[model samples]
Target: MLCFGIILRHILYQKKEAMFWYNFETHNFETHIGWGFLSAFYIASIFALQVI
Candidate 1:
C-alpha cells in the first residue's frame, strides 16, 4: 500500500510538471507570433505609405 501511494504521487507530480511546460511553451509561441505579425504589419504600412 505504501509503495502504491508513492507511485501515484510521483505520477501526479510528473503530470503537473509536464502540463506546466506545455502551457509555457504554448504561451511563448503565441506571444512570439503575435508580436511578429504586429511588427510586420507596421513595417508594411510604412513601406506602402512611402510609395516605394
Candidate 2:
C-alpha cells in the first residue's frame, strides 16, 4: 500500500500535477490493548503447566 501510494505520487509529479499528489493526513491510534500479549501469555502459561 505504501509503495502504491508513492508510485501514484511520483506519476502525478512527473505529469507536473504535483497538486494532485497532495493529500490530507489522517491517523488513528486506537487499538485493542494487550490483544496479542495476553493471548500469548495465556498459551505459554498453559504450556508451562503441562510441562511441569
Candidate 3:
C-alpha cells in the first residue's frame, strides 16, 4: 500500500503540467477555483506534510 501510494504520487508530480492541459480542455473543477490557489495549496500541503 505504501509503495503504491508513493508511485501514484510520483506519477502525479511528474504529470502536473500535462494534467493542467488536460483539465483545461476538459473544463474540470479548476476552472472555478483557478490554478493559483490550487498551486499554493498544493505547495503548502507538501511543505506541511514534510514531503519535500
**Model number with the top TM-score:** 1
The C-alpha lDDT values of all candidates are 0.60, 0.43, 0.65
The C-alpha RMSD in Å for every predicted model, in order, reads 21.6, 17.2, 4.7
How do all models score by TM-score? 0.45, 0.36, 0.41
lDDT of 2 by residue, 1-51 (tens): 555555654663454332223211222122222333544564575566556
Which rank order by lDDT, best down to worst? 3, 1, 2
Off by over 4 Å in 2: 1-33
Report the lDDT tens digits of candidate 1 across residue range 1-52.
5555456556655755565577577776765565556556655655564564
* Ranking of all candidate structures by their TM-score, best first: 1, 3, 2
Model 3: per-residue lDDT, tens digit, 1-52? 5566566557656667776887778978855356657666666755655653
State in Å the error of residue 22, model 2: 36
lDDT of 3: 0.65
Which candidate leads in lDDT? 3
In candidate 1, position 46 carries an lDDT of 52
